[model samples]
Target: MRTPLPKDKCVAAAPLCQSDGEIAIIAEFLPRRIELTRADPGCISFEVKPTGDPRVWDVCECFQDAGSFELHQGRVASSEWGRATAGITRSYSVAGL
Candidate 1:
């Protein structure tokens, strides 16, 4: 089920599962992505943290609204960070879309 969120607030929270080989790529690229994402005007909050499992990262991001989230998606899709993680597995739960 979708999490409860106001219509004007968008959120994505979940785990990013990485393979042994993908871990290096994520580590190399995620920092810059986090920097850029947090700088976005519509970003409310963003976080990515490593879990007890080395291969999993907990990701939680909130945007001002659906429009903001869509814009973020577009930006990421064309970004180098997006390309690097394109093949990585992600289990995300998003609401307010």
Candidate 2:
């Protein structure tokens, strides 16, 4: 279910959409990356989808809020997960939801 944005103070500083993420990983590392992402609590929903070309895979993640999103970002960047799968194109637009 699509969750409504919380009107509480926790979300006051957060963007309207909270978070939107898109990641493109080299296919070989996708399984590991997906594993890492789905393990994060902040990720309200996570999905790994195929690209037409077998060489690429796309990741979609939606976090509960900005804080959750930030937490996930830091975790991914600092953990073995990030180091293990570092490469290819990662495009994220998180500002203003």
Tens-place lDDT per residue, model 2, 1-97, is 3342343312111111111222332434557766877787666566666667444444556666666667878887886656744543444434323
lDDT of 1: 0.76
Prediction 2 TM-score vs. true: 0.58
TM-score of each: 0.82, 0.58
Candidate 1 TM-score versus the reference = 0.82
Off by over 4 Å in 2: 1-28
Which candidate number maximizes lDDT? 1
| Per-residue C-alpha lDDT of model 1 across residues 30-55, encoded as one tens digit per residue | 89999999987677788887889887
Compared with the true structure, the alpha-carbon lDDT of candidate 2 equals 0.52
